[model samples]
Target chain A: SQQGEEDPQALSIQEGENATMNCSYKTSINNLQWYRQNSGRGLVHLILIRSNEREKHSGRLRVTLDTSKKSSSLLITASRAADTASYFCATDHDYKLSFGAGTTVTVRA
Target chain B: GAGVSQSPSNKVTEKGKDVELRCDPISGHTALYWYRQSLGQGLEFLIYFQGNSAPDKSGLPSDRFSAERTGGSVSTLTIQRTQQEDSAVYLCASSLEASSYNEQFFGPGTRLTVL
Candidate 1:
């Protein structure tokens, strides 16, 4: 069974708008990581947040994790056409990664 | 000199044929992983290799799916007697270590279509 599940199967917004995606997991994890995939290509690692950390920032990307809720959210501020892709949240448990179904984001320029 | 790489960027094979996908990890990476992603589905773990230790093949869905890492650098995934249901993108990733905090760098992936 998949450990992580993302809400909002698809999202659309204008280039400069903010986009947020949420992921919920079923088990305890050591860390949560976010990735971006373009078309049929492999996923690119975006950011990773440890369970002890509540929030992390990279460039315009912000990620928040709530262990109590077993959930995490990835926020992309001032989105760009280049940011249009499928975003997935992966949970690390016992050295293995379980990914969510992912949220497809479309940024109209 | 850059990042993880996979060969045969695209593969199309008829049903009942066999296919092989290759992956090359970054230098000094100790942890390698293989995953499969079908249309409208998330990435599914297939296998994991760590150093000289035995690989973790627990994620393999069936006996037809097998993988091997030689010299602890290049890895190959072979599917025998492929079926149409095996059509998907095969992804390979490598990390600095097996630790939970280490980020995995992924290859472009090998898209397989079994007709």
Candidate 2:
């Protein structure tokens, strides 16, 4: 069974706009990681935020975790057409990682 | 230096036929995982391997599904008597270690279609 659920199952926005996706999990986790998958392709690791940390940034990606709320969010600043992909949030517990349903975002040029 | 790789990018087989999918993890990677993603659905964990230790098969849906890892480097997932419900994208991933902090690198996935 999956432990995480992402909101905004699908989103579309013009290029250069920021896209935000939210994920909520049911159990405690050691860390939460995000991944991007283009249609018919493999997933690419985006960023990982440990439980002890609250926020992390890499390039145009930003991830925020609120363990108290059992939720996390991913923000893509200044999105581009190439950023269009399905974003998934995964929670690592013990040695197993559970992924969410994922949010599909489309950045139109 | 290469990423994880899976064989047979696409497979089309009869419903009663058995199929096997292979995965070759990156060199020196100690952890490997298998997952299935149905059309427009989330990934479902199938199995995991850590080094030479016994694999974690708790996520496998049924006895029809089995997996083996040899030399702790290559793994194979076998589905006996395939069914229409088993059609999905089989994904393989590998990480440097079993720790939660390690990022899992994924392969392009094998798309299985049961006719």
Candidate 3:
């Protein structure tokens, strides 16, 4: 079974708007990581938040993790056309990453 | 420095044929992993190798799916007697160590089409 599940299979917003996606995992995790995939190719690492950490930010991306609820959210502020892609949340347990179905975000210009 | 690299960016094979996918992890990386992603789906863990330890094959779907890592640097995933349901993108990743906090670097992946 998959360890994580992303909510809202797809999302679309204006270029200047913000995009948010949530992920829920079934098991305890050491950390949660967000990844971006373009053209269904390789996945690019976006942000990682440790279980001990509640929030993290990098550039225009913000990640929040709530171990109590076993959920995480990724927010992309000031979205751009380039931000159009599929976002996935992975839960790190032991040494492997279990991923969810993912959320596809489209930023319309 | 080079990131993880995978071979045969794309592959198409007939059902029942055997296919091999290769992956080259970043230098000095001690942990390597394999994953499969179906269209519109998230990645599924396949295997994991850390240093000289035995690989964890818990995620392999069946006997037809196997993988090996040589000298702890390069890895290969093999699928024997491929089935149409086996079609998916094969992804490789590597991290500095097997530590839970370590982030992994991914390769472009090899899209395998089993017909």
Candidate 4:
């Protein structure tokens, strides 16, 4: 079973706008990682936030984790057409990762 | 450095036929993983291997699904008596180590179609 569930199954926004998606998990995790999938094929690792870490940033991406709530959110600032893809949140535990269904984001050009 | 690689970018077979999918992890990567993604669905963990230790097969859905990793570098996932529901993208990933702190590097998945 999937551990995480992403809110807002889909999102559309103009280029240069900010896009935000939320993920909620059912169990504890050692770390939470976000990945991006293009064309429903390969998924690329985006960023990871350990349970002890509250937030992390990488380029245009920002991630936050709240262990108490078992939730995480990913924010993409200044969205670009290239950034349009399905974003997924994965919870890592015991050397395995459970992924959420995903949020499909469309950056209108 | 090269990234993880998977072969037979796409495969189509009739039901009941056996199929094999291959994955080649990046050099020196000690941990390899296999996942399956159905249409519009999240990835489902299929199997995991770390170094020479026994693989964690806890996530495999059925007896027909089996995988093996050799020399801690290359891996193969095989499906016996394929079913229509078995059609999905098979993804392979490898991490530098087994630690949860390491991010996995993924391969361009192989799309499997069971007719």
Question: CA lDDT of each candidate?
Answer: 0.93, 0.92, 0.94, 0.94
Model 3, docking class: medium
Best by TM-score: 4
Clashes of 4: 0
Worst 10 residues of 3 chain B by lDDT: B36-45
Residues A1-109 of candidate 4: C-alpha lDDT, one tens digit per residue: 8999999899999999999999999988889999999998899999989999999999999999999999999999999999999999999998799999999999999
Candidate 4 residue lDDT tens string, B15-48: 9999999999999999999999997555899999
| Top model number, DockQ | 4
Q: Tell me the tens digit of each residue's lDDT in model 3 across B1-115.
A: 9999999999999999999999999999999999999865558999999999999999999999999998889999999999998999999999999987899889999999999
Candidate 2 has a TM-score of: 0.97
- The CA lDDT at B32 in model 2 is 97
DockQ, each predicted model:
0.81, 0.74, 0.76, 0.82
lDDT of 3 at B101: 82
- Please give fnat for model 1: 0.85
Cα lDDT for residue B12, candidate 3? 99
Please provide, for model 1 over B37-103, each residue's C-alpha lDDT reduced to its tens digit, 9 standing for 90 to 100: 9875558999999999999998998999999999999999999999998999999999998997899
Runs of candidate 2 exceeding 4 Å displacement: none
Task: Report the lDDT of model 4 for residue B25.
Answer: 96
On the 0 to 100 scale, the lDDT of residue B63 in model 4 is: 100
Docking class of 1: high
All candidates' chain B TM-scores are 0.96, 0.96, 0.97, 0.96
